[model samples]
Target: MISVEGILFAAALFCCALATAGYLISLLVRRVALAKISTWILAAGFMLLTLNLLVAAVHWTGWSSFGSRHFLSIYAWVIAGIYLGLQLKTKTRLLGAFIAPFILLFLIAAAGQGADRNLVPSQWQGGLTTLHLVLAIAGEALFVLASAAGAMLLIQNNLLKNKKPGPLGRLLPSLGDLDQINHFGLLWGFPLLTLGMIGGAVYAAFVWGGSWPADPKVVWSFAVWVFYGFLLHQRLAIGWKGSRMAVLSCLGLIVFLLSALGIRFCLATVHNFI
Candidate 1:
């Protein structure tokens, strides 16, 4: 018999899968109406996932049972939630074609992980650690949105440059709107990530003392933070926008993602749970 959590997870996954198909179809066939419908379907999946997480939390005996599965589940949830929230203020519904696949991928990854395995460890479980995870995941979710918007901007720009913006170009969001989403993402994501890192650093000081900074995960995280900061700085101070900023945003996300995979799998680090 399937548990309530399992039922919710399965239901949410189904919704996301259907929504992904809908969004992809909307993009391929230039059906804006279908994309709008897909948005509601994706929203349903997000709500179901929210309930699933709450139910899972009830069984979590402290943070010790919080495994990589839980982490990825929450990560996917944040991404979905943020993307849906942005829809209220931006007309980037078509961009769901880019975003839904990622949400689906994270959920699929979560499904493959050991649900009961401990990821945070006993010694590191606390309010500060929780804050670090939440804030960092939220920040990263925004970055994902920024990259999606940036990616779309690139496609739209390419179509415009070639003077062949077919029906799809008309369906895409305005370049200004895309750039604004990218700006909002960088502006808010940077501060949240910085605060999350500070919390992590404080916790590390208490747990790992002077040697924490030397850890490969810590080092890579700091480097990513620095790179993220530079992108934010360029956007705000240097007045960068349009295709250039869009290109950099896509590049930043790709490099950060690739290096993150390398660090997680290849390096010896205390953050192995993630």
Candidate 2:
């Protein structure tokens, strides 16, 4: 028999799927009504995802729900929550076309991986891990938004360069707005990620008596941080924007994907706790 958590997970998936479909249709059909419907549906999906996480946390430790598989699910939840909040503040419903698919990808991965128990050691559980994870996930969620914006920017750029504001292009957010999202994402995500990495180092020193574990995840994570740091420097100091910024953002997302997922599948690491 399916458990309550399972039911909630299923419902969340269904809602997110519907939201993605609605957003995709909105892009194709050029309809504000459809975009509004998609926004509400996405909001419902985010709420259900939140409930599912809450239920899992209640059954265990609040942070313990972040097992290998379930962690991606939580990441999806974070992305949705962040996107919804940003959508409200920025009123950029058109970003759903790019963002919704990312949520779906994470959700589908979660569904495939199924549920699993968190493997956090007793000695490792506390405020340190919680802070590290929360900050890191929040940072990554912002990167998710940035990547979405970068994608939309590329699409819009292509259409504009061709002097064809096609129906789909017409449905996209303005180039300026998308660039702002990209800029804001980098501006906010960098500091949080830096703090989170520092927190992780501190936690490692406390638990394992060493700061650097030479773990694959840790190494790749550092690389991702450095790459983004360089990107930020270029954007801020060098005033890079337009296609270059968009391309780099897209490339950054690719590196992030490999760092986040590739290490999990391809290499053994001490960071496998999630």
Candidate 3:
């Protein structure tokens, strides 16, 4: 007997998959109308997933819930919220073609993981831990989006610099627009990332008694931090822009994903394996 929640989740997954397919098709045809439709459909799917997350939250308690929510629930919503924000603020419909597939995969993975039924915090790590986690995810989300924007910028820059844009190139935003988005994304994402790292440092000291670098999670976090820090330094000191910034963001995104999302897949993080 399938519960109502299960049915809703299935429907949501279906919708997400459909949206991904539609967006992919849009890449070939470049229909603004279809792109808009895909966006709405993706939003509808995300809404259903949000409902599912709330239902799961009602069923769980303790840090277990928080941990599980981090892996299965919170991250996807954060990314979706980011793309939606990008959609609202800019004429970035082209991103839908690339972004939708990623969302579909994330949501599909989320659905498969199911919600953890008892994730309430079991210790007194302080309110700061909760705040830290929230901040950490926010920063990671920003960086991820910035990275995506960076990749787009690079593609657009390369196509333009060569004086011969390809067919797929037609689907991309102008280099100027991509450059602007990368700049803004980094402008906002970097600060949030810095705060996340600081909050994480505090949490680590309180929890592990200064046993910081030993944890793989912390190691990866620092690795990503260093990468982005270097990017920022180059951007400011070297006057890096356009292609250089785009490439840096591309590398930065790769590091961020492997650390924040991929590390969990290895069963190596406190956030639980999804």
Candidate 4:
């Protein structure tokens, strides 16, 4: 008998694989309908990934399987969710081209990271830990989605400025709409992040003795906060818009993913076990 996690992950892998194949097919065939189909397939993949996490939460929460590593899996779903959210406002399918493959890559990496029953922080057993983890994930999702939108906008803008429009250019939403989403992301994502940082710091201080910097997680989190701070300040005070703002969001995610995943896993940071 197959476990729920295996079934869900298998379903997700299949969906993402199909979506990527369809997008790649569209590239050769140049069929607009194929691109639309890819979007729906990608959404299905996202649904499967979310179900995988839900099953894991039910079965592994007691064993501490829902912490940091799970965040990477959730990140893939969150990216898909954000793309779906954008669909309500636009008819662009080009995004699925880049986004679907990116998500596929993340989930594959997530599979390698796998489940970490022992990764849950011993000190975070109470309800506050749940709050911290949940908010931190939700916040990270928004910021990363915003960053992706910014990147899309930059790609679209350059194509327009240079008077050359191709498949990628035609597939993106209007620059104006993406810019608005980017603004929404920064405006909302920053506050949630602030709350996350505060909650995490307090949690850390309680668990790791009096030393506030006991974890490399602390350093990365602080760096992310400061980077976003500069982004927010520039957006509000300097009237920055379009490509410039998108670049900021792009840079933020680079630092953010590094802090969130790269540092935690590859570098074996303090949060590696958590």
All-Cα superposition RMSD per candidate: 1.2, 2.1, 2.8, 2.7
Question: Candidate 3 has what TM-score?
Answer: 0.85
Report the lDDT tens digits of candidate 1 across residue range 97-175: 9999999999998888877888887888899999999999888888888989999999999999999898989999988
Candidates by TM-score, descending order:
1, 2, 4, 3
Q: lDDT (CA) for every model shown?
A: 0.90, 0.85, 0.72, 0.76
lDDT for 19 in candidate 2 is 91
In model 3, how large is the Cα lDDT of residue 50? 78
Worst 10 residues of 2 by lDDT: 61-70
Error of 4 at 23 (Å): 3.6
For TM-score, the strongest prediction is 1
By the TM-score metric, which is better: model 1 or model 4? 1
Residue 75 lDDT in model 4?
65
Expressed as tens digits, the lDDT of each residue in 49-105 for candidate 3 is 778767756765556655443454566677777888778878877776666666666
Ranking by lDDT: 1, 2, 4, 3
Q: After superposition, how far is residue 254 of candidate 4 from its true place, in Å?
A: 2.0
| Best-performing candidate as measured by lDDT | 1
lDDT per residue, candidate 4, 141-220, as tens digits? 77876786788799889999998878756656789888887888788788888887788778777877687685677788
Candidate 2 lDDT over 1-274, as tens digits, reads: 7878888888999999999999888888888678789999999988888888788887875545557556778789888988898888886798987899999998987887647666465568788887888789888888878888998899999999999988878778889999999999898998999999999899898777864667888888898899888889999999999778989988999988877778878888877744
